[model samples]
Target: MHFLKAATIAILSPLVSATCTPWSTPGTCTATSSSCDFYTCLESKSGCGPTGYELGYALPFCNAITAVSSNLSVNGQAWYSATKLCLQNALSVEASCETSCTNIYLNAFASHVPCYLDSGFCELSGADLKVFFQVVGVAGVTSNDGLALFGAVLQGCVTKYQNGQVNMGWTKWLVRTLNGEI
Candidate 1:
């Protein structure tokens, strides 16, 4: 049910259909001709605007371990709460970072504690997001050092969609799965 609701929201949001187009001057070209025109120029280029678009990730208060066998995963409501707060904060920080740093690749990231029996280290050591982001020249950071390395892996995943790589989001995935569409 929770997944269903999230899926609904994701489907409704305009963010999914949003696409970046290049800038062009008026009277650039005509509709019937192959010559340059506003519409044609827009179609040829797909890059962010001068300020660039912002990307954010909300950290859900999910348990470090999701146990399918025992169905003992953390509460989805609590996880969503943390995710909302974390994503908002991440966007804020990203805006600031973009303003302060040159060549700032605008991306949002978050790292949170998981409620697993074992220490987070033992449970999360295998996260592979770092390698993903390293290929793109971005590093993911977490508020907690212990979560930093692992956090990068998550950020790596997030960055994978940087410049609009994926058409669907986590919420969409959940909805599709729940609807027997996956």
Candidate 2:
């Protein structure tokens, strides 16, 4: 009995301890031990530009997304590219060229909408893209916010996504938000 139990435990250990990979978003990454804090930790990386945040990190994420979007057969190819570019430029992006602010959000939004239509959809079925929108939306706003609060938000989103709680609703908001109509 002891030998059988030991073998069963060993075989089932992997299933019992399986953890999700890459946080759902930076908000989900909010935690002392979260690996999702990559953006927060790049205060001095300079990709954040004059605002003192990191937007450069989005490059790699964008690259990964380019591939994922293709493999996943994302909904809107143009919007996906635009969204990726907005993320790549998140540090200094603005909502509109007519409007200027410290945040890159406006730039990202504007850029994203440039490729959008009345019903164009961006491939946001992936956690990475979802997190990109949430984080970049608040890059300027949360640059100086408390880590504790930010971490909590990030962690909550992460948990939600990990549990399959996210859906088209959030993605629709993301699209509308980027289009400057929300």
Candidate 3:
């Protein structure tokens, strides 16, 4: 009986190991890139954008911004600084970093909506507004030609999060917002 039990354990070990694949970490920006382009990094399959299950780990927009800032050229650094400033100002206006704000900007670009001009949404004036537009233009968010490039993936994540199929940090916020609790 002991021998039979040992044989069964040995036989099942390899099968279990083979069947259970480990989770892979998402890719980040390359340190050797000539120029740091946020859109390219965000949209690339193996770049800063997290696909499927990886979305539960961190906010994709923030991740991409961090990755792109890792190794930036002089011009890239300038753009990064302006972008950070614009993002900070925007966040101060009740916009959430973990929510769909980033994607909304991208979507606005697709919908031909000048988000900066939306006083109710932007609320930025003068220099801040100018910088905001500059950053948005440089990030290529306004030049997408009406394509919701990341819409499908973002929608899938939202659906999965709403259904409790994923454990993202923003799930509670999303749920409350959807239920009109916020």
Q: What is the C-alpha lDDT of each candidate?
A: 0.29, 0.37, 0.35
lDDT of 1 by residue, 1-182 (tens): 22233334334643655333323333221222111132222223323344322211111111121112123223332333344344333333222221322112222221222211111212112222122223223333333332453444334434433434433445235335656999
**Where does candidate 3 clash, by residue pair?**
none
Residue-by-residue lDDT tens digits, candidate 2, 1-182? 22233334435644764333332223221122112233443323223554432344333434444444544333544456554443334322121122222233233332332222221332244554454454345553355332332343444444444455544544446545656988
TM-scores for every predicted model: 0.22, 0.27, 0.24
> How far does residue 126 in candidate 3 sit from its true spot (Å)?
26
- In model 1, residue pairs whose N, Cα or C atoms come closer than 3 Å (at least 3 residues apart or on different chains), thus clashing, are 29-37, 58-87, 59-83, 61-79, 64-114, 129-153
Better of 2 and 3 by lDDT: 2
Winner by lDDT? 2
- Show model 3 residue runs off by greater than 4 Å: 1-139, 142-147
Candidate 3: residue 38 lDDT (0-100): 28
Instruction: Score residue 38 of candidate 2 by CA lDDT.
Output: 34
Candidate that would win on TM-score? 2
Assess candidate 2 and give its TM-score to the true structure: 0.27
For candidate 1, the lDDT comes to 0.29
| Lowest lDDT block of 10, candidate 3 | 114-123
lDDT of 3 by residue, 1-182 (tens): 22233334435634763222221334442322223342332334323244321232223443554554535444444544544334333322112212233332332222222111121112222343344334334444423321232232234445666666655344445556777999
